[model samples]
Target: MRPPKPTVAIISPALRKANNGNWQTAHRWSRFLRAGYDVTLASEWAGPTAGDLAPACLIALHARRSADAVARFADACPKRPLIVVLTGTDLYRDIRSDPAAQRSLELATYLVVLQDEGPFELSTAHRGKCRVIYQSAIACHSHAVDSEYFDVVLVGHMRPEKDPLTAMRSLALLPDDSRIRMTHVGGALDDEYLRAVQALQAQTWPLGERYSWLANLPHAETRRRIAGAKALVISSVMEGGANVIVEAITSGVPVLASRIPGNIGMLGRDYEGYFPPGDAAQLAELLQRASQDIGFLTRLRQQCAQRAPLFAPARERAEVIKLVADALRPT
Candidate 1:
C-alpha cells in the first residue's frame, strides 16, 4: 500500500476575492503540490482541532498579517515544519520594526523570497535559511500592437507603495510630438489616490487623448492588454517581487521599471529599462526614446527575453517542490 500523502496548509491573508499576488501565489503553489501532498488554503490557521486532520507542514504568506496564525501553529506542533514567505512590506518595512513580524521570521524553519535580491534584506542569522523562488508565468503569444499609438500599460493597485501617480504625472512631461498613450489598470485601493487619478484623467491634453485609467480588468483581459501594449511600466516605490513583471515578460512585452531593489532583482542590476522611482521627468524621457528609437525598444525586448527563462512554469514548480521537501525532511 502507498503511504498517505502528507497534509500541507497554505495560509494566505489575501484570498481569491482579493485578486492580489498573495492569493495568486497560494493558488499556484497548491496546484504544484497537489500531486505529492494534500494541500489546503485558508486566511488563518487556528491549529489542529479534535476532529480535524493536522497538517504536517504550514506555509504562511505575509509575516505581519499572518503572525497570529504562525504563532499558534508553532505552539501547537513545535516539531512540525513551518515556512514563512516574506512580502515587500514585511521585508522593507515591518520586519525592521514590528515584533510580530520578527517572531514569524524566528519561528519559520525556512523562508521564501520571490526574487534573488530578497535574501540580502535579512540579517546574517536568517540569511542561511532563505531561498529565492522567482514567480512564474506561461508564455503568451504577443498580440498585434496598435501602431496608431505607442501604448504603455501599468498594472498595479492604486496603493501608496505602488506610487501610481508617478505614471500619471509622466504623461504631462512627454514631448509635444510624442505619441505615447498611457493606460493604467488597477483598482483604486485608496480613495485619495482614486481622486488623484481621476483629476489627472480629467485634464485636457494638447496632444488629444493621452491617458486612461481603466480601473481593474479580469486577469485574462489584463494579460491580453499587456501583450498588446508597446511596453509595460512598473513604478512601485517598493516590491518584494511583482507578478505583473513575470506576466509582462512571458507575454513578450518589455518592462520599464523603477530602480528599486525588487525591480532590479527581477530585471537584472544592469537592465537598461530602469527609471528612478518617482522620477516622472526621467520616465517621460525614456518613454519618448522607446517610441522614437527602434534600437532602444529592441534592446529592452532582448533583455526581457534573457530573463524569461527564470520565470518559467517548470522552474517554479521544481523549486517549490524542492523547498517543501527540504522543509519536511528530518532535521
Candidate 2:
C-alpha cells in the first residue's frame, strides 16, 4: 500500500489568472510535489480561526501578499516549515519598505529565491536561509521555419512596468534595409498602453516600417511563434524570474533582455544580448546589428543555449527537494 500523503498548502497572489509567473510556478510546483504530497492551492488562508489553519508545510508566494500567512504559521507552529518565494517587487522593492515583508523573510524556515543572485540583497544574517531555484521549462516542438529576414518577437503584458513600447521605438530606429520586423504580442493593461500601441503601429518609422501587434495569443500558439522566431525581446523595467524568458530559451529561440538584475541573474552578467533599460536608440542599434551581423546573432543564441541547462525540470525538482530536506533536518 502507498504511504500517507504529506498535506501541503500552496499560496499565491494570482490564482485565477494563469498568465502570471507566480501562479504558474505555484501550479507546476504543486503538480511535481503531488507524487509524495497532497497539495492544495489557495489565494489566501481560509481558516475558521487563527488556530484552525494548519498543514505539514506551507509554501507561500510573494513577500508582502503572503507575509500574514507566514506570521500566522510562526505564531501557530514554529516547528513546521514555511517557505516564502520572493517576487520582483519583493526582492527589489517591497522588502525595503514593508515591515510585514521583512518579518516574513525573517520568520521563514527556508526562503526560495527564483534566480541565482537573489540572496545578495538579503542581510548577511538572513542570507543563509535562502536558496536559489530557477523555474523549470517544458520545451515545445514547433516548426522553426527558415527565414532570410530575421523576425523579432516580444511577449509580455502591455503594462507600464514592462515598457513594451520601447521595443517598437527601438525597432523604428533601425536602418531602412535591416530586414527585421519586430512583432509585439500582449494584452493592453490600460487605456494609455492601448493608445500608445495604436499610435506606434501607424507611425512611419524604422525606415518607414511597422510591426504586427496581436492583442494576445493563446499560450501554446504563442510558444509556437516564439520557437520559430529569430529572437525574443524582454524589455521589462523590473522582473523577478520571468516565465517568458524561460519559455523563450526552452524553445531554442534567442533573447535580447534588458540589463536589469532580474534578467542578468537568469541569463548571466556577460550575456551579449543586453541593452540599457528604456533606451530605444540603443535597443534599435543592437537589433539592427543582431540582424545584419551573423556573429552577434550566433553569440546570443549560444549564450541562451548555455543558460538553458539551468532551467531543466529535473534539476529544479531536485533542487527543491534538497532544500526541503535540509530545512526539515533536525539541528
Candidate 3:
C-alpha cells in the first residue's frame, strides 16, 4: 500500500475574512504544498488530541501573534518540525522587546522571512536557522496609463505604521502646474483616519486638482489599478515584505518607496527611487520629477525589472517546497 501524505498545519493570525497579506500568504502556501502534503490552515493550532495523529510539521505566521500556537505545538510534539514566519512588526518591534516573540524564535526549528534583509534583524544565535523567501505575484502586462495626469497609486491600509499622511501631505506641496494625481487605496482601519483622508479631499489643491481615496477595492481591481498607474508609492514605516511591492514590480509599475529597511531590502540598496520616511517635501519632489522627467521614470522601471526574477512564482514555489522537505526530513 502507498503511504499517506504527511499532514502539515499552517497557523495564520489573519484569515480569509481579514483579506490581508497574512491570509494571502497562508492561502498561497497551502496551494503550493497541497500536492506533497495534506495542509490544514487555521488561526491557531492546539495540536492533535491524545488519540489523534499529530501533524508532521507546523508553520506559523507572525511570531508575536502566533507565539502561543508555536509554544503549544512545540510542547505537544517536541520532535516535530516547527517553523515560524516573521512579519514587519515582529522584526522591527516585537522580537526586540516581547518575551513571547523571542521564545517563538528560539523554539522554531527554522525561521522564514519574506525578503532578503530580514535575517539581519535576528540575533546571532538564531540567525543560522533563518531563510529568505520572497513572495510572488503573477505578472500582468502594463495597461495604458492616463496621459492627462500622472497617476501615483498607494495601496496600504490607513494605519499609523503605513504613514498615509505623507502621501496626502505631499500632494499639497506639489506645484500648481504639476499633473500628478494621487490615488490612495486600502480600507480605513479607524474613524480618525477616515476623517483625516476626508478632510484632505475637501481641501482645494494648490496643485493639480486630483486626489481620490477609493477605500478598499477587491484585490483583482486593485491590481488592475496598479498596473495602469504611472508609478506606485509605498509609504510604510515598516514592512516585512510587501506583497503590493511584488505586485507592482510584476505589473511593470515603477515604485517610489520610503527609505526604510523593508523597502530597501526589496528594492535594493542602490535603487534611486527612495525618499526619507515621512518626508512629504521629498516625496513631493519625487512625484514632480517623475511626472516631468521620463529618464528618471525609465531608471526606476529598469531597476524594478532587474529585481522581478527574484519574485517569480517558480522561485517561490521551489523555495517553499525545499523548506517543507528539509523540515520533514528525518535527522
Candidate 4:
C-alpha cells in the first residue's frame, strides 16, 4: 500500500447549521481537499493529543474569529504552514482595529482573500503573502422567469454588514405601477430586523404585494430561487466576496450589486449593475430600470456572463488544490 495521506485541518467559525458563506466555502474546500489529503473540519483547532498526528497544515476561515486557533497553531507548529482566510469583517473592519485579527495576519504562513480587491486592504508587510482565490458554484440550468413580475432575489442574513434593509427600503421607492418584486432569503439575526421585516410585510399594496421573505431556505432551494429569478441583488456594505454572486452568475442570472470593493472585485468595475451601498433611491432606480428596459437588463446579463467563467468550479478547484500542494511542498 502507498503511504497514508497527510492530514489537513480546516477551521471554520461558521458550520453547516449557519448555512452562510463561510460555511459554504469551508464545506466545499473540504470536499476539494479530501481527494489528496485526510481532512478534518471544525470550528476550532485543539492541538494533537496522544497518538494523534498534527495536521500537515491548518486552514482557518475568518482571521478575527479563528485568531485563537491560528495563534495556537503558530505557537505549536512554528515551522508548519498556517493559512488564514479573510472574511469581509476581517478585511474591511477587524484588521484595522482588532489586535487578534492583526496578530492572525502576522502569524499566517499564507493569507487568502476571496476576491481580487482583498489584497489592497493588506499592509505592505502582509500583502506579499496574500493571494486571491475566487469562490465557485456549479452551473444550474436557468429556469424561465415569470413575465408578470421582474423578480429580484437577495440572499443574505439580516445584519448590519449585509445592509439588507437597503434592499427592503428600495422596494418602497419603486414606481407605483412597477412590476419589480423583491424576494429575500435570509433569517433575521435580531428582534430589530424581525420587527422591520414584519412591518414591511404587513404594509399594503406596494411593499407587501411586492416583497416576499422566505427566511433561510436550504442551499439547494436558495440556488433554485436564484436561478429562477430575473436578477439577484446583493446589498451588502461589506463582503470578502459573496458566494451568492457566484451562484447568480453561474445560474446565468444577472446581479444588481452594491458599489463596494469586494463586489467591484467580483463584478468588474465596468459592469453596468451597481448601486451605491445603502442608497435606497439609487437601488430603486436600478431595479426599476432593469424591470422596464429589456436592453439594459440584457446588458447586465451579458456582462455577468463574461465574468462567469472566472468562477467556474474547475478553475477554483485547481487554484485551491494548488494552494495546498504548494504550501505542503518542502521549501
Candidate 5:
C-alpha cells in the first residue's frame, strides 16, 4: 500500500464570508497543497484532537491574528515546521509593537512575506528565514468595456488601513469635463464609512455621477467588473501585497497604486502609475491623465503587462509546493 500523504493545516483569521484578501489567499493555498498533501482550512487551530496526529505543518496567515494557533502548534509539535505569513497590518503595524505578533515571528520555522520589500521591515535575525512569495491569479478574458466612460475600480473593504477615502475624495479635484468614473466594490466595515459612501454616491459630479458603491459583490462578479474597467486603483496606506492587483494584471487591466513599499514591490519602483498614499490631488491628477492621455494610459498598461508573468498561477504553485516540501523535509 502507498504511504498516506501528510496533513497540512492552514489557519486564516478571515474565512469565506469575510471575502477579503486573507481568505482568498488561504483558499488558494489550500487548493495548491491538495495536489501533494491533505489540507484543512480553518479560522483557528487549538492542536490536533485526542486520537489524531498533529498536522505535519501549520501555515498561519496572519502573525498577530493567528498568534494563538501558531503558539499552540509550536508548543505541541516542536519538531514540525511552523510557517507564519505576514499580512499588511502585521508587517506595517503590529510586528513592531505587538508582543503576540513578535512571538509568532520568533516561533515560526520559516516566515513568508507576500512582497519583496517585506523583509526590509524585519530585523536581521528574522530576515534570514523569510521568503518573498508573490501572490498569483489565473488569467481571465477581459470583459467588454464601456467606451463611454473611463472606468476605475477600487476593490477592498472600507477599512482605515485600505485608505479608500482618498479615492472618494479625489473626485472633487477632477476637471468638470473629465470622463473618469469610480466604482467601489466592497462592504463598508464601519458606520462612518458606510455613511460616507452613501453620501458620495448621492452626489452628482460634473462628469455625471462619478461614484458608485456596489457593496460586496460575489468574487466572480467583482472580477467581471475589474476586467471591464479602464484601470484599478489601490490607495492603501499599507499592504503586504494585494490580490486585486494580481487580478487586474491578469485580466489585462492596468493599476494606479499608492506609492508604498508593498505596492512598489509588486509593481516595481519604476512603474509610472503611482501617486503618494492618501494624496487626493495627486490621485485626481493621475485619474484625469489616465482618462484623457492615451499615451500615458498605454504606458501604464505596458508596464503592468511586464509584471503579469510574476503573478502566474504556475509560478506561484511551484513556489508554494516547494516551500511545503522543504518544510516537511527532515532537519
Candidate 6:
C-alpha cells in the first residue's frame, strides 16, 4: 500500500487564467507545498454533496473573494486547519467594512501576511494567530547602471492603486537634457487607464520623449527585464506586500518606490530611494540624482544587495513548510 499524503487545498478569488497577484501566489504556494502534501488548487469548495472537495486542511487567499468557500470549509470540517492569506485590498480597505472579510478572519485558524508589519493592522483578538512570510524569488544578479538612457522600469498592472502614471509624469520634471528613460510594464485593467497610458506615451512630460512601455510577459522574461534594468520603480499608492519588490531585490535591481506604509515596511525606514506617493516632482529629482551621481547609485546597489538574502528560495520554502508543519502538528 502507498503512503497516504496530507491533502491540502488552496483557494483563491481568481481562476488560473486571471493572472492576478492572488492567483499567482496561490499557484506558487500550492506548487511548493506539494513536495510533502497532496495539494489541490481551486476557486471554491464544491461542498457537502461532493466527496473530493474536503481536504485535510484548507488555505484560502483573499478575505472577501474567497470568503464563502473559507466559511464553508471551516463549518464543514471544524477539526481541519484553515489558513487565510490576506491581500492588499483586505489590509487597507475591505477588512475595515466588509462583513464577509470579517467572517473569514473569524473562522481562520491561522493567518499569513506577505510582509513583516501586516499583523499590526489586524484587531487584537486576531493578532496572535498571524505569521509573516516574505515571498521569495529565484535570485538574479544583473544590474543596469550602464544603459545610455538610465532606464527606470515599473512593473505593475494599470490599476488606480498602482498609480502607474506617476513615475512617467515625473520624468517630465527632469531637465530637458536628462538621459533618464522609463518603462511601464503590465496591461491596463480598464479602458480608462489604458487611455491615460496612451495619452502619456504620446506627450512630452518628464524629458518628453524618454520612455518606453511593455504590457506583460511570461514569468521568465519578466525576471530577465528586472535583471537588466538600471532600476526598478514601484509607484503603488497602496500595497500589502509587493512580490515584484522581492523580485527586484533578488535580481539585484535597485528600486525607487513610493513612500507608502507597504513600501516603507519592506525597504526599511532609513533606505534613501523613496519618493512621496504621487509626488512626480520628487520622483523626478531622485531620478536625476541617481543618474548624475555615482556615489548614490553605489549606495542604492549596496543597500539592495544587503537586503537580497531575505528573499532567497530556501528561506521562503523553510518558512512555508514550517507553517504547514506546525499547523498539522498534534496539539
* Top model number, lDDT: 4
Report backbone clashes per prediction: 0, 0, 0, 0, 0, 3
For candidate 2, write residues 41-132 as lDDT tens digits.
98886533655447778888998988877887777778888899987788888888999999988888888888877888788877888888
Once superposed on the true structure, which residue ranges of model 1 sit more than 4 Å away at CA? none
Model 6 CA RMSD to the hidden true structure, in angstroms: 1.8
TM-score of each: 0.97, 0.92, 0.97, 0.99, 0.98, 0.95
lDDT of 1 by residue, 1-331 (tens): 9999999999999988888889889999999999999999999998788999779999999999999999999999999999999978898889999999999999999999999999989999999999999999889878846686899899988998899888888888987777898888889998988888778767877433788888878888888889888899999999989999999999999999999999988999989999999999999989989988999999999999999999999999999999999988987
Q: Residue 33: error of model 3 in Å?
A: 0.5
Estimate, for each residue in 1-331, the C-alpha lDDT of model 4 and write its tens digit.
9999999999999999999999999999999999999999999998878999789999999999999999999998998999999978899999999999999999998999999989999999899999899999999978955688899899999999999889999999998899988889999998988998999999999779989999999999999999999999999999999999999999999999999999999999899999999999999999999999999999999999999988999998999899999899999
- lDDT of candidate 3? 0.91
Q: Pick the winner on lDDT between candidates 3 and 4.
A: 4
Q: Cα miss at 86, model 3 (Å)?
A: 0.7
lDDT of 4: 0.94
Judged by TM-score relative to the true structure, which candidate is superior, 4 or 6?
A: 4
Candidate 6 lDDT, 1-331, residue by residue in tens = 9898999988888866666678778888887899899998989876656556578888998888889999889889998899999878887677899999999899999998887778878998888999988788888777566656787788888888899778767876788889888777788898987787777778855444687768877767777888888888998998988888888888878899898877766777788999999998999888899988989988988888887777787888898888888888888
Clashes of 5: 0
Candidate 3 RMSD computed on C-alpha atoms after optimal superposition onto the true structure: 1.3
Q: Give the per-residue lDDT of model 5 (tens digit) for 144-231.
A: 5558788899999999889999999999889888888899999999998998887887776563399889999999999999998999
List all candidate RMSDs to the true structure: 1.2, 2.3, 1.3, 0.8, 1.1, 1.8
- Candidate 5 accuracy as TM-score: 0.98
Angstrom error of the Cα, residue 260, model 3: value is 0.6
**4 or 5, greater by lDDT:** 4
Q: Per-residue lDDT of 1-331 in model 3, one digit per residue for the tens?
A: 9799999999999998777888889988998999999999999987678897989999999999999999999998999999999978888899999999999999999999998889999988788999999999899978945587898899988888899888888988888888888888888998988888878877875442567889988888989999999999998898999998999999999999999998888999999999999999999999999989999999999999999999898899999999999999999
Show pairs that collide, candidate 4: none
For candidate 1, what is the lDDT? 0.91
